[model samples]
Target: MIEGGALVKNGHIQQQLNQQVPDASDWLALSLLPRLGAGRLKQWHHERRAWPQQWLEALSVPQRHYFLYLRHPQGHGQVLQPMLDWCTAESSRALLHPDHPAWPALLNELPDPPLVLWAWGNLACLEQPAIAIVGSRHPSSAGRHHAQAFARALAEAGSCIVSGMALGIDAQAHEGALSAEGATIAVVGSGLDHTYPRQHRSLQQRILNAGGLLLSEHPPATEARPAFFPRRNRIITGLSRGVLVVEAALRSGSLISARLALEQNRDVFALPGALEASLSAGCHALIRQGATLVTTPTDIIEELGGPWRASSIQGAENRPACREGGERQRAGHDPQAQRWLVLLRDGAVSLDELVLRSGCSVSDTLNALLALELAGQVVMCGNGWTLSAPSSESGAQTR
Candidate 1:
């Protein structure tokens, strides 16, 4: 991982973590070594299984000299102490070594796997089956629609949505998964604490609040830089079983992720865009290069050897907005909230009752209700939550 300028391998690292031994500190110190990238980290691990001890003695002369410099007070204070303090925030953050259950096995397939992965939010989302949806940072409305629709279908079918958390396609995908009450992982280019694109800070928090995850190779304090993004792309592709390019210009980073996906032996799926649109050029190129042309979530699930869960896919279909209080629900409102509105139409119900009726967590139910309320489709009274106004005979919910 790029966090704090170090590399961390999985197996032996896990042993040190479990023992709560000083070796863990040694691992952190090793990661802080100047210019020590994943390739050299792997080499060091192979040559000496016992790291930070025999591991140091086995280092080449230059590496050992560099390590000696970092061992000094100035170097240690500057490079390692911050990471130690950041990792100590155990409630909101964690460092994932190779052996951590949250670690993705697909990352091991990379020629240069991250030595350690820095993560914030629910770590369990890492273990779920994932599909990456990426495209231009500035997308056409149609492109945004496809990204959201496909992500929702995949998420409903029990797949975790993964993306770079960029503005256009990535944000739509994350919103789609969250709307479905599904897991999403945002692989950020900057440190967990330094949210890039600043606008997405709310989105990042929502991901955490909804039991999703935010991941970074950089440590908590690392600022976002252009160079860090390509590195972030690799992790986005690495954690996924397949990658879907919703839209991209010829020079887009989404194409970079698609290329990396192919390199990592992950399936690459691209949605066809307009013939003349520049945004479609990269996706078209990928299709020409043998990427699967996909129009729906089943194309991904089937290609990745996952079951075709018809029921789950059915749950993601869009429904019409309900007109309540003689006011139409906002356009593009979440369909999931309409399901909750149906439950609330009869009368106010307790949060527990909503959970029971909807089979969703209290957090998810509350989030849906909040969205509905914000859209003026539902009201929360002393009784609990109820439709803000009576629904038509057909019973549609706005948001």
Candidate 2:
């Protein structure tokens, strides 16, 4: 058992430390050393049997000369200590290194996977099929809605929703899945013990409570640094079977994840958005450059094929009913709600026709329709509100 300030058990920090297999502490210590990185570490790990000490010894001559010329007094050995301490401290927090048996095999396939992963919640969830949903951190209302709704639908179909767990789109994506009482996985850039953006603490707890997993590559006490995010993005794509870009600016990190996905041979899907919107430029570029264009969960399922079939799309279409009546019943009911349900049963009806058929005043019908939408019972496609597949009525009643 490893005991340190980092070891958290049932919310209590443990004080005793024990030697563990693979000594992730040692790996973390090496990784944190100045001038040492995944590339260099791999070089050493792959080239020599007596690598660790041998590599350190080889750098001594050049390292000392460079330090003296630069008038910096830090020695190579001295710089390595803090990283070692970091590893030891992190071990107490349930953070595991790549050497751990619990580490997901998918991560190893990346060209430069994190040497260590800081995981919170159940580790087993990593084995399940996962789809990564990424988009603008400041997504528009529609973008946020789509992100969450898509994630929820995918989650309901027995796939885990994976995202970077940022604000806006990322938060909604996780919420969407949780709203459906489904599993989600949040891959963060900060340490497991630290939740960035502070506002998401409550959301983070909800995720854990709902059996979702939160993961990070940074050690405890590590703040949100600029460079840590791109590395984090890689893990987001690496862990999933495919990556979905919902809404992003041309230079957004979401696009980087898509690139990484392609490099890693994972499918990339982009949601087409308004051509005039700058926020959607990245997605459009991806689509134009060969990424699959996804308009619904069905599009995603069809692209992935196999278990992710058109039936999965039908399943997603049916989810609205389960969601409307689930433990977290939708917010409110209105005349439009009943009308929308009826129209959905009748299949895609024009707005004008819907008003005529539902028999409600046009103004009242529109208002009710909007209310039903907030409840997730209806979705607007083209010029009409298509009844979301999973109607709330019982099967016999629907028939």
Q: Which candidate achieves the best TM-score against the true structure?
A: 1
Model 1: residues with Cα > 4 Å off, grouped in runs: 1-23, 43-48, 52-54, 66-78, 307-311, 318-399
Candidate 2 structure quality by residue, lDDT tens digits, 1-399: 222121122122111112232255455554454564576555555564352334445444544234222221233245434434554563333456666777787876788877777777766678678899999999975676678777877777777889978988888888877876777889898876678879999999998888888888776677887788898999999999999999999999999999999998899999987778898899999999999998777678777876666665453433322122223222243232453576666566665786687665543444344445544566666445666545545212755
lDDT by residue for model 1 (1-399), tens: 211123332344434434422244455556656676777666655554554455555565566555555554565567767786787867868887665666688887787877778888888897788899999889875676568767766887899999988899999899889877899999998888898899998998899999999988777788999999998899999998889999999998999999999999999999887688899899999999999998666677777775436555553333223334444343236455556767876788877777798876544454455445434566555457677654423355233
TM-score for all models, in order of appearance: 0.73, 0.71
Alpha-carbon lDDT, every model: 0.74, 0.68
- What would you estimate as the lDDT of candidate 1? 0.74
Q: Hey, what RMSD does candidate 1 come out at? A: 11.3
Clash count (model 1, backbone only): 5
lDDT of 1 at 145: 57
Where does candidate 2 stray beyond 4 Å? 1-22, 43-93, 306-309, 321-337, 341-399
